[model samples]
Target: MTTHPAPAATEIAESTSDASLARTRRRSAEIEEQIAADPGRFRVLTGDRPTGNLHLGHYFGSLLNRVRLQRAGVETFVLIADYQVITDRDGVGPIRDRVLSLLADYLAVGIDPDAATIFTHSAVPALNQLMLPFLSLVTDAELRRNPTVKSELDATGERPMSGLMLTYPVHQSADILFCKANLVPVGKDQLPHLEQARVVARRFDERYGRPEGTDAPVFPQPEALLSDAASVLGTDGQKMSKSRGNTIELGMDADTTARVLKRAVTDADRHITYDPAARPEVSNLVLLTALASGRDPEAVAAEIGDGGGAALKRAATEAVNEMLAPIRARRAELAADPGYLLRVLRDGNARANAIAEATLGEVREAMHMAY
Candidate 1:
């Protein structure tokens, strides 16, 4: 009998990646159909860590989709992941201000506080309590293998990985399952994190729910709600990140935005084109213009063809400033009334706590620990 060698690690990893993408795409389609057919059946949980002011990347990537979901009548929960700021970073700098700033950004972008539940991670105790039992559902090796955690740790450079950082996926699982959120909007890179949440939900149900003769599962295995929005790159042609200082913040004035766009990197070749692979920097600018102006990127590129990089910068600056004008005005109004922002947070936190408390009660009962 001939023995075949095991597949190489890289080969296996690639295969796994492809399979995961396929599954996510398939499930996203089904969920989309379900949402359209019965808009009331799904609940969405999506959020951002309060690191800094909101940028164009946040606007185009997740914020717009969030508005679409809320308008679609889906029950939505937006968690301000304040605790997550320290996951890979040193300290939470001006965390309170950032949280309020995030809230203002949401409102400016048409996220109605009355329609959706917007809450914070630190405010929801029962939500965090779910982390205790969830931590036991997965092993150390499994946690280490989580790509999101590994990437975050790798980004931390010489800093030692903290315990919380290592178990970040479990914390995220708590974020999703605590509110029984069945739909999570995620990009392709975040699919693994959502998969880990699904694992926790399934394992918890199989081990704890069935033995109690429970009529319903303790947690819902969340599905990925993929966004078709292309990833927004920064002016420097890298991933748009606040830490890099390459983002056009939503609150920036028109002059500041113009100045930032003037410095955007582009090729020496005068001709403008939208070949993302070859001319990424130039293509990025074109894409920003297209997104802001509601035109096709390729068409934008074609229109700016032979106009060169300077013309592209001018176009992007104009389009972005025009697009953000109304949002900036609204944000300014919100900023003037800090008291109102606090009220929104207070109400959202209270609502979130009540829901989390109920979920935890059920969890404790299922584990036979409720006295």
Candidate 2:
């Protein structure tokens, strides 16, 4: 029999790229279809770094998806990424308090503790241990090429990146795989992190999963649950972030929300418009009002036409306050009893630890390191 030639490296690369693109397109369609159809049940993993209070950006970006998925019968895991805070920070000052505050915000936003497991990253020892083996599966070039890490470095303007910062994507892989989460709700900007996690999962399965006639993978390759929510902007017309102090906190009172919006930057034109390129500040406000009031941004702009910046700001402020009133009330009620918050964390940690321990045992067995 004549031997056949193996596929060239370039051909292999092209094939992989095409496959990835197809998967992405399919996932996008799935998200759109999910709106009309029940998602059945899937394990979803998503979280936040308890850097500060959760804001509108957090709400529209991922928190809303979390609540929806949890209610849709999906087993959701919300990790308070406490360990990720040190990636850029000089110290972990009052991280405990911050974690509690973040948890309170989750509760306030209707993240039912009984429905979704909310655990601190540091509380799960096996998750950290899972990182050690995963680091070897990734390369330096791959980590450096990650857009999220590059953006962090560029934004910080610092040299000699911290090892933890560089390997953050890998650590994130462990976080997702430790729970074997097959669905991760993320914005388009965060797709890279989720993709890297998929790479890690594939690598591990290829290296150790195939045994004789059996193919058993320990981790499920997660897909991105892309959201259709509009991009939320800070009061300064920039990306909404806690570091910039431009966020509208979820727990803000009515007056505080109005004062913040009143100072929001806008164009000097008397008429309202939705041209983001021409007037980002005004467009940002329109987008915020649209999200808060469940109206189209263009419609919102048309309704406020010839009303000037004052009217636009007033509408945005009213919409935000109206949406936040009940949330703020619930948050205040939850925040009053610190003991209740602690108990929730403790219960979540215990459940998460049990799942992580089981996963770590399987990982150890696959690597031939199990005793």
| Top TM-score hit | 1
Error of 2 at 233 (Å): 0.9
Each model's TM-score?
Answer: 0.93, 0.90
Task: State the lDDT at 286 in candidate 2.
Answer: 96
Report lDDT per candidate: 0.88, 0.85
Location of the lowest summed lDDT over 10 successive residues in candidate 1: 3-12
Deviation of model 1 at 278, angstroms: 1.2
Clashing pairs in 2: none
Report the poorest 10 consecutive residues by lDDT, candidate 2: 3-12
lDDT of 2 by residue, 1-371 (tens): 22212232122223226575567667767764774475554788889998889999989887887888888778889999999999988988899888999999999998999998999999999999999988877767667767777787788775778999999989998889999998887765677788778887877876667333446688887887766777889999998999898999998889999999999999889899999989999999999999999999999999999999999999999999999999999999988888999999999999999999989888887888877
Candidate 2 has what TM-score? 0.90
Off by over 4 Å in 2: 1-23, 31-41, 155-158, 210-214
RMSD of 1: 4.4
* lDDT tens readout by residue for model 1, 1-371: 32222232222134238776787788789988888888899999999999999999999999999999999999999999998999877799999899999999999999999989999999999999998988877776667667876676677763669888998989999999999999999888777778788888877886678325568888987888888887889989899999999999999999999999999999999988888999899999999999999999999999988999999999999999999999999999999899999999999999999999999989988898888
